[model samples]
Target: MYTLHYDSPLGGILLAADEAGLTGLWFEGEKYFANILGPEQQERETPALQRTKRWLDVYFSGREPDFTPPLHPVGSPFRRAVWELLLQIPYGQTTTYGALAQQLAAKQGKTRMSAQAVGGAVGHNEISIIIPCHRVVGTSGSLTGYAGGIEKKVRLLQLEHVDMSRFFVPTKGTAI
Candidate 1:
């Protein structure tokens, strides 16, 4: 894998690539990913660095990622399916994890999955903002469990012009 560091308006970002194109993106440092993967990502994530960095440049600039470049996010088949489904989500729209799981379950003839599973897939995505996982929210429109932290998730949502205030859960039993 090839790796590169990208400095965005928010912070320093890490990119990982391989023969598969792009593999991972982390706002945390190599040390953080290394802790997660049990080896240094920078040591292995050295192949798709150039292309991934370029792709990120386009995304942060507000253009949609062409996604023509190679990508290799590692996860369970179900998680991969979830991630692939996430790709179909448009640039500025949102969906609930329950809704996504329901959409997939509809094809398999039973509602076998739960929103938490979808949330797991969303949380484990190695690629960030570009994959547009920020578009997924709680059924109640609350943002939850972003690997990049709520602040960054809010920033990304705002980047797409999604009003952060609209997502805050109201006080207990407050009227609409």
Candidate 2:
């Protein structure tokens, strides 16, 4: 595995990639920072890492990246499915966990799916911004459960031009 360090406007970010693509991106000191990396990781800038840096550059400049870098997030099949859905969230839009659960249920051909379960998968997303996990919110528009911290989540949404009036930081909740 190869890694690169980037100085983002919000904070320092550590990016990880391998032959396939970017495997992880985490804010310094954020929950689950580098959690997906194996012991054999090295600090070297690969093509994937460089491309990711460019993507971040566009993003931090307060504009949506016109392109997405290759991402190879590691997780279970269910988690991967959830991450795929996260990627579909529009650049400046937000969706609720319950809504995600309903979407997953329809995709899986089930009558119902648990919002808590969807939240669990969203919480464990290792790819962060590129996968757009920060776009997920609680049913009431509560900005909660971001492994990168709620403040960062809020900043990212603002960077994407999401209207902050619709979302609120929960005083008490998971990952608060």
Q: Highest TM-score: give the candidate number.
A: 2
Among all windows of 10 consecutive residues in model 1, the one with the lowest summed lDDT is 29-38
lDDT of each: 0.71, 0.92
Please list the Cα RMSD from the true structure of every candidate, rounded to 1 decimal place.
4.6, 0.8
Candidate 2 lDDT, 1-176, residue by residue in tens: 99999999888999999999999999999888898888998899899999999999998988889999998989999999999999999999999999999999999999999999999999999989999999999888899999989999999999998999978999986685
lDDT (Cα, tens digit) per residue for candidate 1, span 48-128: 666676777787787777664567877788888889888888877788899889977886688567878787888778887
Q: What are the per-model numbers of colliding residue pairs?
A: 11, 0
